[model samples]
Target: MLCQDSAFRLYLDRCRRHKFGLTEAQLPDGTHNEQDARDWICAACSIESRAELDHNLEAWQTFRAIRNRFNRWRARGGA
Candidate 1:
């Protein structure tokens, strides 16, 4: 239920905004929704589902790496 977690969802949104340099409202295609973040997470973690992050060590590690990078990006004032 990681994707369902409010804080995590917010984190995803923030990360996306930072990476894309655009807010959800500013996106030309009208995408950048929660599902898009979920899909991005799944693809980055190499998992078919977000739930696998809870049980799959490799996916969890990959997710941690992504989070760490996001944290650094935030620390550096990205976006």
Candidate 2:
């Protein structure tokens, strides 16, 4: 999973390089989310998804993998 994070971070880094950077966007629900940011991150880079910008599956998978790794590492150290 760490390998995946490294890969994704590298991807997102490329995204960051492509986009000026991820920026917050207001959703239809009227809450600010990373939708626009992720959209820019992908549309300007790799792995486009048809999911709602905020709920984009590609982003979710990347986030989930990173979070899971963090949680597992935290558990090991009683953090």
38-75 in candidate 1: lDDT tens per residue?
A: 88889989999888988999999999997777667657
Clashes of each: 0, 0
* Candidate 2, position 47, lDDT: 54
Ten contiguous residues minimizing lDDT sum, candidate 1:
24-33
C-alpha lDDT values of all predictions: 0.70, 0.45
Task: List candidate 2 segments past 4 Å from native.
Answer: 1-53
lDDT of 1: 0.70
Model 1 residue-pair collision total: 0
TM-scores for all candidates: the values are 0.60, 0.32
lDDT of 2 by residue, 33-76 (tens): 35544554455424565344366666667656655655665566
